[model samples]
Target: MLPFERIITIDRESKVPIYRQIAIAFINAISQGIIKANTHLPSTRDLSKLLEVHRKTIVAAYDELEAQDWVVSVPRKYVAVSAKIPNLKPKKWMDEVNESAYRALFQLPFKQIVVPKVKSNAQLPEVIIDDGFPDVRLSPIDDLLKIYRSYTSKKHSIRNATFGSAQGSLKLREVLASYLSETRGLNIEKEHLLITHGAQMSIYLAAQLLLAKGDVVVVGKPNYSKATQVFEQTGATVVEVGVDKSGLLVEEIQAICQQKAIKAIYVIPHHHYPTTVTMSIERRIALLKLSQQYAFAIIEDDYDYDYHYASSPYLPLASSPHQGNIIYIGSFSKLLDPSIRIGFMVAPFNFIEQGVALRKLIDVGVDGYMQNALAELIRMGELKRHIKKAKKCYFSRRDYLDHLLQEHLKSQVSYSLPSGGMAIWIVLKKEGLVEYLVQHPQLAIRRSAIELNAFRFGFASMNETELEQAVLLLKKIIEGFELQGVKGQL
Candidate 1:
């Protein structure tokens, strides 16, 4: 007998149709090489008897597989595996036919736009380094579990059980408004808030609401890649403003605005993405002044303002008014958990009605129960305690990363010690440095090139011990790069 593994397991209670499930099992078997190419499969009658299903059901399953080109029927014996299967390459004549079909469908006469294929999440290599995610290992999960159980045990609030209002739960908004006023000095009412899926969605929605095709928007050089993509997708022309230690160059922004067609300025003033440099108060004032004179809006993305390791956090530009020119965006993802997916935009009161309307069309609203739960957390001062604890944790991690980098990779790379934020942007001493680092067997996936030599290291996720190991590995990779003498321009 052939070494074919049994692939089908019928789940009578499953919502999936039986025939479809059977077809999937067969395809899985074929892909796994359990059922070899050109091998004979048992007849429908035999399979029906083995599976305790009607003969018609087995026939239906086989017919479905045949329709998908997974198998071919032979006369009076058994079904032979087909030369072609969907998404499977069978090193045979079928490859030529499939290649021709694919070319006909995807190839164009003109110069084709090369779109990078999106890697599935499952295909992405797991990051064993401490820098890949936030440090959730130390989270007070026991406390949270207790809170969750207590909250869920109560009678389900009908308001929270259904899709929430587009404005988010009023209680959450009210709590947030007070928190912002007290913490960040931004005095805002609940009516001006529109909860979103996350900071990215808020940015995307704001771009959609404010920008038109071919409109000009100034973005900081080496900014958030995801934000850049969102603006590009909206058909806006993104002009990059250079940054020094003080943050974005105000003169470059003024020069762009002078062109008289710019729509908005996107910035992360508290701690800029990748670079982790905070904009000075003078620069913030200049930016706000430019927005007033130039007739464009400012998208103030206050992404990591909640956790300041330094003396105190800087107040957001939105807190100081330039008369409805600022659209302030904030998120709880970093403070709580990324999975929470809760963010809010504080717009001018005049724009709130339309903004909420747009939000309704997007996701209907943020998760109602989560919103209510967060509201309760805020009301009970649990969120405040969480933020305080998170700040201390992040501060320790940031300091440890800085110390390790300086101690290990000092001569090869340089980065500023940021006061706050989850990441540090390292500028390599030589161009094409990341490509060399990633070639190491240990770091073949984790290290990625942002532009050329510049890369981001998110240190908030790892503990001091893990960070030490990572730094040692990174140093070894850099030493190898130097030995190779691989020279390229940044």
Candidate 2:
């Protein structure tokens, strides 16, 4: 006889009735072949005694088993297992076949997107200094959360589950129209604005809408790689323009315009990537005038316009008197945190309408409640106040990092303190210096070789202690190279 006690343990506290537990256990045992077909089950009275339950509980368990065809009544006043049982086998082979067939037939040709590899947030190095990234520690998360919850709780507001406008929450657009006019000198209405996941999305939308195969898209030589990838995906030929201390050489771009029918120009005029050199006022004016003369679009990616440490930064080109044919995009990712995917595009209403149709096809719509909460943050001046406080903290950090670099790395590399953005570009006196540092496991910072001699360092995310450690590591590496006398020519 099979021992019932060892096979099944009863949980007196379980919400499932005691009898149901017994029945389920027996059924599972039969299906698993632990209890074979045609086996005799103990009598109800005996089971009652064995299980320490009332005889009625045992009778209920037996009745359940009989109903499920696991056991049946016998003429000898005994219960016997049903002759037939469910066939139980692992479906591994079947699953593998289905997956293989799907993979062969259902895969899309994926285009490679150029994305910068950032250190994982889950496990960061003890000391991390990189191109400027926002410190989420300083984000007004609690206030944003409170605002989100408030909007969600209001039953009348469509901030709950309803699909929002593809152009973005109208409330957010209204707030941004006023906000951008005051802050960046851009006079635009809500209708001209299209909210995006980030500036990248805005760039992609503009590329798909404005560009054609073999069309020319101009970019700086060491430009934002991701934007380059976006333009390439739209089948546009990317023409590289030279960038100097002032910014993109407008003359070079003008030369290209004369040679080819330039469809658009992608620029990060405020703090150019990897170099952090602000575009000179003259170049800004020239680029604007050229855009008019050539009849090409201007895709201005103003990613980090908020963290200016020196005198008030120059107003964006979109705010300039010559603002036609411009698709101005800005991101809240830098202001709040990168994870908050909120960016806005300022363009003509027709362009926005086209972007909305494309956005719906891709993303359907963004989070309406979150956008509304951000709007409230702007309306109440919480975001503005936070930016002011954060700018001061970042200014101090930037100056400290600059001092550390001068003290430790002055002999080995050349750099200029950036006027506005989060990073400093350092031209190394030696080649392969960065590749050597990358091999070590302890340090992680954004390093990119500029020309054959320089690399960029983004310092906005690091604190004083981390900055100190990073500078010390850099100093040690250069010393190690000197001690070994391992100098390589570029």
Candidate 3:
């Protein structure tokens, strides 16, 4: 056992709140590495007695530390060291003001910027089939709370609360290094992982890191809309490449790169967003080759690898040998709950340091306690078990939705049965189906789609019963469209 140093020193005369002083001291110790990772410290009672302070005071101090992600707490037992010292700083006032100005100007009511009205109801439906949100009903809340409680009872050192190193928690990186290597066959070290808020943030960071204004990036047509928006926000010219049953047409991507100076290609190969079509292994290899030949990067958005229902799920595009040009993005949002907000980017070892630096500038580090808890979850094999349970649940829902679609709206609408992922993209026989449905007397909510003819339905969020009702309602809407006899434009 490591020697327990006197971690708490209180000055009653100091003007600073006891809690704030305690938080500062804890951060200092963590920075010096005096308190190591996973090291369980004395209980709050023991620490209060040792420091001759009231237990309540220590509790308050510890609460501050926990909020900052410096320590982890367990009920009535002990607290544990969860993260290392973070190296972060507050943004300059000028930068903040400048950003605020830009947003204000951009958000000024403009014709091109279509802002949707907020929903009036405070309570959303329990089963939301239209929104592409992962089902969080089956998350391991008990285990998470247990872990959270375990880490919060100790006295945090000064080092632990300070800004962390940009790469994120070392323990998280270490665990993800092994997890990705084993599960996805991607060879990466702790140094190669840069943790972010989620895959969306990963996309934004990759754009910030790799792209400059006026750069060209090839994206799949009818791609993840948010990704396209991110690229556009970065002032990059987005060129859409058509996707077939196999995947993005590699030859078309090649032709685009040949014709223009392409910076990167953003794609979801394992299960494409909205439309869950796995890119073929041959196409994956071809994409890597194209990137190698064209001297561009491939941003592989491997969003839903955990719940694959196909006989053989498509391998990640980054799994193959390439010239260190693949920026592979993964997230825990789909596997676990979106509230977890932990995702990672796997890049070449050389890019790790710079990426971490950029990440620090972006969000400092992600919540340290969550990262530590996730590390513990991964270490104890709880994560895999949760994923297994989720896969079964989602697959059942997928089947239920498919059955409902076939039974009701068979010939009027067409959809590809997805092997995995949270949502299915559907194409209606008539254009403007979404408009027509929203305008229906019964339903008043409007939605946006990539095309007037296409819309996505997420099966994961709804249970069998809720799904049955939603499909029945949707079928009625489709039938109405058929009755109208809308023809394609000449």
Candidate 4:
């Protein structure tokens, strides 16, 4: 046996528990090749005496190591490092040089992989106008935590944390079935739904199942860029369809269908991204007909159907009768917070079965503990109450922003008040606004579509004070441009 004193150190002053420290020391020793596989460890009593710690502490440390499969205990015998551990020691100088030389001898055929532009490192201003993210500060987190703690502390919840179905928690699916049916008029059953990490994952799963190499997928111009990237990542070619005030031009999509076999058409009809244009009912019927004629899948991303302000929002195309070839996805990330990462996809049973299989390969399952707690929240009617409360707050912010824009920016910018969703699409009439805003360290905005002149200003995430500050700064910038007689160029 190796000397226990040489292999392990007990740091009584550290914030980490004595047992955890002991287990960490053993792990480090094993990883660094100081102890070989199947090497016996000192007895719990001896190690305890050697480290001057309690015997129970040493026992706890060994339990941890065994539980993690780092060590194993023989029947009526002492514990030893697991023999299953494969040697992974750091390579010597010659071995590393030889490996590098071996790799250099091969000519790789892989294409250049460009990094996706999901986020930027540009310095944030004092006040940021986001693209319709929810104000998580207003969420019912206290109540959620209380119920979460209650569910997880139960003895049966051990299975929930350890293993779960790839289809996600059955309870959550059942609750969502009723919830979507009641709210959005979707008549879905638990068998037709698959839970995902977020709307992004839902999009990815659909792409993997429906798209193949060189398959054509149609997306709206100025679409959700993130979803576009996800579809393209699956080796499918993404074709852009121009979007107008009435949403995607279905006539243009029909024109494309005559040219090639299209696999899918991805669209966000309700309050379309960046522009916030709702698809006309006429266009919706026309697109549905085209999908049937071409036998292509329609990936409908109804991201923010919950937060409508002007009137009751239109029910999703998936909720319609005779709805086929439609894969509808929605997310609660905006309702609660993006970090929650709860999203669901509704489709035909066969598609759902395939999606669950693919999901198992990527992630074993969604968070069972979180899904169960959310279901409880839905059952207790807390989720509905929170949405009601949040709606009122968001409506007020939207109107306040509207009033501010009309008062301060009417001459320099033009916008249509969105009937729903959390942002107003502002079209800049002058060119210098983007450059001028750069000088002001207290104002931030998101550019819309492919044009730097069009921007989206979301009010839901900011308080009224921050909103006012941002607009006032923008007004000042525009006024300075007007005085110089500078016509804003695209």
Candidate 5:
């Protein structure tokens, strides 16, 4: 006989009734093959004695077993494990599937994206330097969330509960149309903007719609890496133009265009990524003229338009004439937080309509509730107030980081004080210095990045304390590294 007492340990503290516990135990026993088919169960009175429970409880357990078909009863004469129950075969719980299943057997239909190799650390570093991003600590998220909750509950807003148009929320677009006009000097209407998940999506849509196989798209040699990936996905030939202190060498782009008819150019006119070098007005005008001359589209990713400290930032290329050739991309995510995916593309009406149709193919729509909520935030002037506050905070952080770099790593590095943007483009004085710094245990630098003996120390994400901590760690690590032999440390 099975060790019935040992198999069915009772806990009085458990919320489950004593009788139900007995029933469940019997069922488990049968399933596990401990209680085989046609085995006679102990009598209720005997089980009651064994379990130290009342006979009524044992009787209830037997009744439950009988009702569930786990046991058969013979009119109070006998209660036995059901002969009708199938033979139980327990599985090998420790067994796993074959190892070959880890890798795909067949070819993927599309080009697989390359995943970057990350350094494996037992714990996350205390100091993380991001590639340029807005500080979330200062974002007006509480106010935005309150608006979101209100929109979700209010009956008047219920009609917009479902997925909105592919173009995006009408209210948000209208608000942006007015907002962009005022802030960035963009001459756009609701019809010209296509709200997307973020600036990357806008970049992708522009790249996909404007480019085709064998077409050429001119970009800087050290351009925004993600934008490069997007353009490459379209099977378009990417021509590399050189960027200088003035910005993209439009002369190089003209040289490329002379050889081949290009489709578009992805330019970051204000605070170019990694380097944070703003384009000169002369280059901006020259590029616009070249666009008219070559009939190529200009993807002006003016994401850091609002982050100026020196003077009022230059108006975007889209704000200039020849609007037909430029697709302007901007982001609210950069202004608030990276996680808040809200960005827009400004293009001609016909082009936007095509993008909308293409967008609908792969997407149902964006979050209508979030869009409306943001629109409310903008309409209330809360977003502008927040930007105004954040800009001042960021300006202070920028200067603080600048001072920290000058104080700590001035001997080992050289950099230009950026008039705007969240990061300073620090160029290392020694060879292999950037690569060695990347290996330091206490640091994780954002890598959109790390080319041309330079990297961006994204100051906006960290406060003065964090900036000080990061800079101090950086100084300590570099000092430990022997530079150019003679006991100079890596």
Candidate 6:
């Protein structure tokens, strides 16, 4: 008989329950062939006595083993290893397993592994100056939950509750069609829309469907990092053009078009990411004409378009009368909360059909109940009301942050108050400040996607009180550098 005492060791301090620990030890022994299949396991009472554990713990562990088909219990006989398990070679214990051993034993099946574009901290700080995230406190979460409860309780929900249309809840698509057409002047219907997990997923679906090897996708120099990454993953070549205060330099794009057959051109047109520069109408019109002339798709990402302050928001280029070959992506995450992963894509019905098919490959659809809840909100005009209330609140917060920045770091940083969007692009006037902020133990901020002397100050997530706290902390960090500067420090 095996030395069962030596085989099973217990650490009472371990977080794993004793029963689970016992079951795991047996499983390891069985899989390693230290205990062969069809071998009788010690009776629960004997093992409990040997291990000095409660009889109940041993019974529970045996039950666990039986449930997993690792052992079978005979009628008034004994428990034995299941005959089903194939003969596996004896292997070293867990502590002895290393990378080399793992490679020798197992195969790494994935052809490609995804690498994240940004490095996220293990945990976020309590107070955050986020990268253009919406304030969750301002989202109409209670109302949304109330509506969600109503739909799930209704008996007909069973029928509508199953896998919804691949494009998402038809109710949501219908409501969004009306809401967008009314608000953004998008001439679209449910057939032209595909609801997705979020804008990133929408962008990814568009890229996978439209781009392939040897294809070329155009983007601005200082563009949204994730969008560029998605386009590149399709094995297509990504071509960067310059961006100015007016947004993507169309002339450079036109120059690129003359040289190569451009497959798609990505633009954040309204309050562009990282830079926060809105494209002029002239550029919008020129790009539309070029797309018609050159036969390339336009991926228009109009995130946070509803929160404009300085002027009336430009209706998306897709709203144009001649709009075609444009794939428009927008997010409800900004209106609701960042955690609420609801976004939509708008294109011609034919393009939308293919997008829905591709979306099914990744996921069946977005959460049906949540999608229906949102549809209810839009139908009752509650969503619009919430947006109106939150927009005003964020507008005030944006101004409050503007005032704080001007008061505190006026000398150290230079920024243009954006016409619209959640963040202000502030360029650090002096060198080494960005690196200093990065290395600071207390500060949590993202480096800009574009390698520039700038960073985005997302004020929308922070309130006046929180903004005051953040700016003061930043002021201290900057002033420490100022003192160092006075000493002609390295």
- Residue pairs in candidate 2 whose N, alpha carbon or C atoms collide under 3 angstroms: 130-458, 131-458
Best to worst by TM-score, what's the order?
A: 6, 5, 2, 1, 4, 3
* Model 2 alpha-carbon miss at residue 342, Å: 0.4
- Global lDDT for candidate 1? 0.76
Looking at model 2, which ten-residue stretch has the lowest summed lDDT?
91-100
In order, the Cα lDDT scores of the candidates are 0.76, 0.83, 0.75, 0.84, 0.86, 0.85
TM-score of 6: 0.90
Q: Is candidate 3 or candidate 4 better by lDDT?
A: 4
Task: Please give me the total number of clashing residue pairs in predicted model 4.
Answer: 3
Report the lDDT tens digits of candidate 2 across residue range 1-490.
6667766668899899999988877776666666777788888888889989999998898889998888888755789888786545523222222122345754778767667555444455555556677878888978998988887778865634255688898788999999999999998999999999988899889899999899999999788887888889888899998988998999999888888899999999999987898999999999999998889999998999987777886899999877469999999988888889999899989999999999889998678988988998999999999999888988998899889988888888887788888788887776667665554456665666634456667777778887898889888878887766645432
Q: Give me the candidate number with maximum TM-score.
A: 6
Candidate 5, 37-156: lDDT as tens digits: 999999999999999999999999999999999999897688999999888874332222111234656655776887778777678987888888898888988888898989888777
Candidate 4: residue 344 Cα off by (Å): 0.5
Candidate 3 — which residues are off by over 4 angstroms? Answer: 1-127, 155-163, 438-452, 479-490
lDDT of 3: 0.75
List clash counts for every candidate, in order.
0, 2, 28, 3, 5, 0
lDDT by residue (100-173, candidate 4, tens digit) is 24556458677655773433426766667678889999987778778788877897875765466888788889
TM-scores, all models, native as reference: 0.76, 0.76, 0.72, 0.76, 0.79, 0.90
lDDT tens per residue, model 1, 35-65:
6677788788877887788888888988898
- Considering only N, C-alpha and C atoms within 3 Å, which residue pairs clash in candidate 4? 430-488, 431-488, 431-489
Q: Which tens-of-lDDT digit does each residue in 1-490 have in candidate 3?
A: 4323245456679898876776676665654565556678677787777767778987887788788888888877777777564543433222322122344556556446435554444455433445455677888767976876666653451234233466777777898899999888898899889888888888888887888889999998778877888888778899998888888889999888778889999988877766678888889888888888889998989877887887645567787888789999999887777677888999987676777777767566556667777888899999889888888888899888889889987776788988888777777776677667654554433234635476678778778887888888887777767677645322
